[model samples]
Target: MDQGQLVRILLSLILVVGMILAAAWAARRGGLLRQSQTRRIRILDSQRLGARATLALVQVDDREILIGVTPQQISLLHAGAAPRDDDDFRSHLDQARSS
Candidate 1:
């Protein structure tokens, strides 16, 4: 192809990529791309025990669940009412660990 044609194609590609990036930036600034404020389920915390194993504290509705996650399956360690504070969560975690 001619040098002029090649330059035109390159400019067109750059312009398209620039437009995509600008649209993403504007959406993020406008909060259109962010996660919603009101979600029913939330992961309170998690700890990685091994390469493929994780212990996660998840809150759903008004209850909290301690779950063990692995590649094979997810197991519920404990399920109880949501804790009021971080300290309460820690105590629950300690109790779960001991059991």
Candidate 2:
């Protein structure tokens, strides 16, 4: 290969790598790659049930819900007021421990 061809090849590789890195950086900075953050809804916890199923605790507005999730479906299992303070969290923990 001639010097011009080698330089072109090198420049193309660098441009491709730079584009990929720039896209990744933009996504991270823009929060496009992160979970949605909203005051009305938040995922508090989750546990995998099987290969494609999970149980999730989601807080929505003033309430929390227990949801069952699978690759094919989503179902609500329970719903209640969400804990808003340390005392409420402690009480819920105590109730869970007792039960």
Candidate 3:
């Protein structure tokens, strides 16, 4: 191959790699292109999620539940204790959900 062709190929590979790295960095920083993934909202939905966990909201269940988990702790929530009063994370979760 000609020297010019080799140079162009090398430049193209570098540009592609740089773009991929930039995209990954942006996603990690929660940029407009890519955003951080979280489990908060999925668990916040009442229909999809079970057992209310808020103060303004009433939770009737004996234990707070975490749904849509990896099956390891998904069912464990059924037996776990719910946070109550200021110590309750469910209430905090509600606030986070709003945000």
Report the number of the highest-lDDT candidate: 1
Listing every candidate in turn, what is its Cα RMSD in Å to the true structure after a full C-alpha superposition? 8.7, 7.2, 13.7
Error of 3 at 25 (Å): 0.6
Considering summed lDDT, which 10 consecutive residues are worst modelled in model 3?
A: 52-61
How high is each candidate's TM-score?
A: 0.67, 0.52, 0.38
Model 3 agreement with the true structure over 15-74: per-residue lDDT tens digits: 999999998888778766554464232233344233533222223443445434432343
Cα displacement (angstroms), candidate 3, residue 60, comes to 13
Clashing pairs in 1: none
lDDT of 2 at 85: 97
**CA lDDT scores, all candidates in order:** 0.95, 0.92, 0.56
Candidate 1 RMSD to the correct structure: 8.7
Better of 1 and 2 by lDDT: 1
- Could you give candidate 1's per-residue lDDT for residues 30-66 as a string of tens digits? 9999999799999999999999999999999879999
Query: Where is model 1 poorest over a 10-residue stretch in terms of lDDT?
Result: 81-90
In candidate 1, stretches whose alpha carbon ends up further than 4 angstroms from where it belongs are: 82-99
